[model samples]
Target: MAEKEEYVKLIGSWASPFSRRVEMALKLKGVPYDYSDEDYLVTKSPLLLQLNPIYKKVPVFVHKGKVLLESHLILEYIDQTWTRNPILPQDPYGKAMARFWAKFVDEQVTLIGFRSLVKSEEIDVAIKEAQELITYLEKEITGKMFFGGETIGFLDIVVGSMIPFCLVRGWEGMGIDMIPKEKFPELNRWIEKIKEIEIVRECIPNREKNIEHMMKIVGRIKAASKTA
Candidate 1:
């Protein structure tokens, strides 16, 4: 464990992929910090509101009272500040490409996957889009062990958080296989290797809990659609 820094707190939710991203960074850096888990479905925390007034989302990393909103920004800050187990590459072009793929994961994969899970009307279309996103990622992934060759990097952290909550939970709870093994053999292998990392194992969202939560969201969406 790293020496405790001056009051580091993260206001996030367990089921939130974005929150999980920051958590993965902190854990990987061996930073000791406090986690304030919020219930997004029920109510919002005052600090979450105060920290992220505009976007109003989880993964608001507060380090020494310097509030950081947005998961990607928090991740960059974590890498620069911690100076240990660096997530982003030091070179200019490597860092740029990493950010590009991370944005794709957020805008394409995460949005499409969540829509598939929570909306009954767009389930099939959304699932198809999610599959296409995974196919694209399979080719983009060039490393043997992770996105950045031997060690986990920024792109890995972004996509890594999605596996347990999105991929694994989607398969187990909804029988939705976004990445088919026969087609996405490389991706499947990458996932297995990323899972082997201790920090990844510890940081991924709870599988069973996320499954139950996703099912509830699907049920509610279905019931509402029937009335509409």
Candidate 2:
């Protein structure tokens, strides 16, 4: 948190869900800032390299001359700094639960589930793991409009950003319906509701492009498997 006059910039990659998460957070908080899309494959900008030396990843948030890495951490910082349109819960217990789900969504859910969409020898197993995660969420999301209920909150942002990339619900990559309507009706309803949110829709990555990328990865893997 800087003083009265501080600059805020979001350096991101177009296809990155992590970047979109930060972007959505900034927009939701009504924070005015410039977005710089870095083509790391083509040209990793000097500014991005300097800001995030360790990871060299996009969605590097520069606020008041301070660099913040990790989308979830940046989100927490945004809520603390903005104080308006607060995304996190005010109560201690509620806040803790939100944080738990956010972390779980990122590490336990997205990390494993998204990889399954890329390229996997055991596609069935990968799909099963993702389905299990979704089923767990399906129960958690029951009766709640969003993860935070009536209003969108921290956990919702974390999980929602990755939904488009998630197999069944998103139809982005494999076009596999990982969370079937009958099996996970609640989660399906929630996904539709979240998609209608303007900010979320604006930040979501393109489905066709996402599917194309997954296809490329699978093709490459098939070629490599033949060679092996």
Span of ten consecutive residues with least summed lDDT in model 2? 164-173
Q: Give one digit per residue, the lDDT tens place, for model 1 in 151-188.
A: 89888988888754555685568777767789889888
Instruction: TM-score for candidate 1, please give it.
Output: 0.88
True lDDT of residue 86, candidate 2: 87
Question: Candidate 2: lDDT of 94?
Answer: 89
TM-score of every model versus the real structure: 0.88, 0.87
TM match of model 2 to true structure: 0.87
Which tens-of-lDDT digit does each residue in 113-210 have in candidate 2?
Answer: 65676544787888788788878889889989989878988888888776644333334456577777899999889889988999988887777766
Measured with C-alpha atoms, the lDDT of residue 59 in candidate 2 is: 82
Candidate 1: clashing residue pairs, number:
0
Clashes of 2: 2
Among these predicted structures, which one has the highest lDDT?
1
